[model samples]
Target: MTELRDAALASKAWPFEEARRVLKRYAKAAPEKGYVLFETGYGPSGLPHIGTFGEVARTTMVRRAFELISDIPTKLICFSDDMDGLRKVPGNVPNQEQMKEDLNLPLTKVRDPFGTHDSFGAHNNARLNAFLDSYGFEYEFASATEYYKSGKFDEALLKALHEFDKIMEIMLPTLGKERQETYSPFLPVSPKTGHVLQVPTLERNLEKGTIVYEEPDGERVEVPVTGGNVKLQWKPDWGMRWAALGVDYEMFGKDLIPSAELSSKICRVLGTQPPELFNYELFLDEEGQKISKSKGNGLSMEEWLTYAAPESLSYFMYQKPKTAKRLYFDVIPKAVDEYHQQLRAYPGQDLKAQLNNPVFHIHGGDVPASDMVVPFSMLLNLASASSAEDKATMWGFIGKYAPDATPETHPGMDAAARYAVRYFNDFVKPEKVYRAPDVQELAALEDLVAALKSPEAALEQIAKKNAVMGNDEPLPEADYGDEDFLQSIVFAVGKNHGFEPLRDWFKAIYEVCLGASQGPRFGGFIALYGVDETIALIEKALAGELG
Candidate 1:
């Protein structure tokens, strides 16, 4: 009993709080099955984008959090909305001309221009599954095409058919005039062409569960609600899907608020309550423009995994999920560093604080006994400066700092090294920024070089100059790995040399070393990049060689 209470207390973090609320509300009115559920959606209109990864990753984090707080056995569903008609050819996908010919057909009925799967929907579905499985996601995949065709939705289809008029009343107000004129809760998939038609429904036979529609070819035909002959229009389909699956909870982007609200009303009319919902704000580009699958304005999942770790991406999803996040490539470095901080700081934190730490959830509560890897941002900086295409680049410097590390034992180091190299090439190479240092900055750079070259004598000189600062923790013996080491050095340099605030000195340090005015913590960077190499950067600045 006490364990349960403590677990619930530890779940005070925002994601866990949301998880606890969602699970408890569902438990009050439990589904027929004893287990609870969480769901995320995917649209297979094109290749899987970063937004798709974010949806599933964020949902998985919540699932991990919910598991900590309660014993509710939860299931996460990755449902693909594949029954939707192909509206247009995506520019990025192959065989645009072929896909254009298949537009207006159900995605499941359209040609797989890539020739990888049976249909366009199946091709993208396979792509989605590839990354999700590679990332080790725990999910049950469901396809709308299979569900409808296999009669899995037949009973719900019947219920919706019976309540058609009510569903129409709920949907009509949300449509524009032209769409309103032709809108019906049911979209009949034409037998001749296998395309979901948008034309006005000619007749509805409630007793026979059939709808008649005039085909574009000028022949009128009736199709049964079962056997995949008819598919619910998107709004009604949302409600029907929830009722059919007994979904307990789901998350979507906030742009679908109106659609979700309409679906909730339709669900009520179908005699079941809507699932609990979380609407995350849209992902934006660096310019703050919204990312759309159609617009192709966001990064792809394959591109992110090419340069970074899944854990870093997962940590990004862990924070401020409800708030809008800028998800361009630049944001990846901070997330990588923050994940490192969480893992490093985790060992000393109390149980409750550890529960709240993202690394705990990122590992799904059974955190490894040790996670002693280099900070990702530091590695990115190190990798950016070095031309090494592999871990050998980082290993040369890493051996100088920590003689204990080798490929035989520290697998984490190897993985981080590779990611850092990829990150530098993909993101830092083209946009590398540099600034020249002025006179005071030059002297500061020279002092930094001097201290790094002669560590013991440098601290002796520092203590003699600033006695009050070095008594408790002497500079030479300090752990270079700690962020405090760099901060203290910057603080000491600023106080002794009359550079009022330390950020100026740190800024100068970055300008000289990294060719940027901002970077990872300097002490940490030196530890990862090597003392001699860092000192060379200061020497270069002193000689005006960088300019």
Candidate 2:
């Protein structure tokens, strides 16, 4: 327990006291094992929003923290409520007309126009799985359709129904409804009909321990439940699930605070332990509106991977308080840059201290010292200047110098690069190597190049030039040129300004080339490819020849 407290305190990103309290409760209530952790979200009714990842990413941190403190083997379950009915069409999803027709049914019942899967639910599930997998999350995905079909949730459902009145009583105030008569507490999706099940009159029969429902035609029926229709309504579902799963901790958005409050009441009624609750702020788009699939304003996890590294994305999710404030995509690059700087600052310190910092909010308020390290992109650019086929060679360099760099550090990098290479053939552009440079950047870059007499001198000149430019301006872009010319510029820059110990130099190059201030390493990138080819690739970029 003491060690656990120390770990929690050490991780500044975490709400140490809150986490500690939850762990203490788990220890008291069930000393045999810690609680199960469930992270749930709706499927990609459209593109999966960044907020969805926020929930899961934060949960991963809490789970990791628990694992650090105790011997509890935490299970992080990412349950997709794909069986839920679609209330509206999202911007990213196609075939709007067809979706509208199936919106009333469970997601699994909706036909998939893309044909990648059997249903819309399956398609979205696949996408979500791909996104989570890219993040290196070890999550057990439980689809609502599968859970219902497999009967894994049957017991919990029955229990909720048995406590119907209590559940309704707990939920009404939260919903600000006079009574729970308008709609049934259950979602009421008919598994047989593949449509919504509408019961006009739903009443709890406490004595009979059943839920009595009346059809439109005036036919009445009673569905028997175990424990007197003790099922929980939506508001109390959180507590019910926590008890059933023995969850130690869970996080929700502020929008769900009312539900969480009601859930606490249910926990008391059920006489079962409830998981600790951590509420976080929602993610907003540039518009300041909540980033939601319904609004079609959110950034998808896939889109993020297309441009940024996985560690950057993870770091974005890692640094904030779950309950603090809204997040934006525009802030991500800075977070990534800071993560690199932090790693470099205390490189020789205790691995834990080096890895742990609350600044890059992964969990609520704690960031553990990460054992994983990867070459920054700037460093990679420096290396690419030396090696043309830089991918493999860069990886080898990483294996030697940064062995701790895991797949999570650079998610989808290989696959994306492979895709780009396959698409463009042997003519992949330099912008692909780094991000496209803007107009002002081109002038600045030309000036820096003119100042250099050799490759090493170019590096020093570039660094000095950048220092003069300050942080307010964008980075300079490379001018259009021949392969040999591009090679000379890259070589000159690498000689002086390049990061040191090779890895650092590579990181520095990525920073300079992309104008990102920090990115993947250069040495490994050059080792992955030959120097001449890489130079040619940069020339192609300057000329705007490759896509």
How high is each candidate's TM-score? 0.91, 0.63
Local distance difference test values of all predictions, in order: 0.78, 0.55
**Candidate 2 lDDT over residue span 107-211, tens digit each:** 777888677799888888898898789767778887756665565556666666676667666665644353435655664443344454445336666565466
> Best candidate per lDDT, number?
1
Q: What would the per-residue lDDT of candidate 1 be over residues 1-547, giving only the tens digit for each residue?
A: 4774576555677668778777667555665676777888888887777778888888887787777667768899999999999988888778888888899899988999989789999998999898799889999999998999999999899888888888888988888999989998888898898888887777888899888889998999999988788888887998998888877788888999999999988888888878888889888887899977667676666666777777888888878888898878888778777777788788898777887888887887767643345676777777766655777878887776668988668876777778878777767755666567787876766666666666564565467546745556444565445445555565566556767576777777776666766777777777777666777766765676755
Error of 1 at 124 (Å): 1.5
lDDT of 2: 0.55
Superposed Cα RMSD, model 2: 9.6
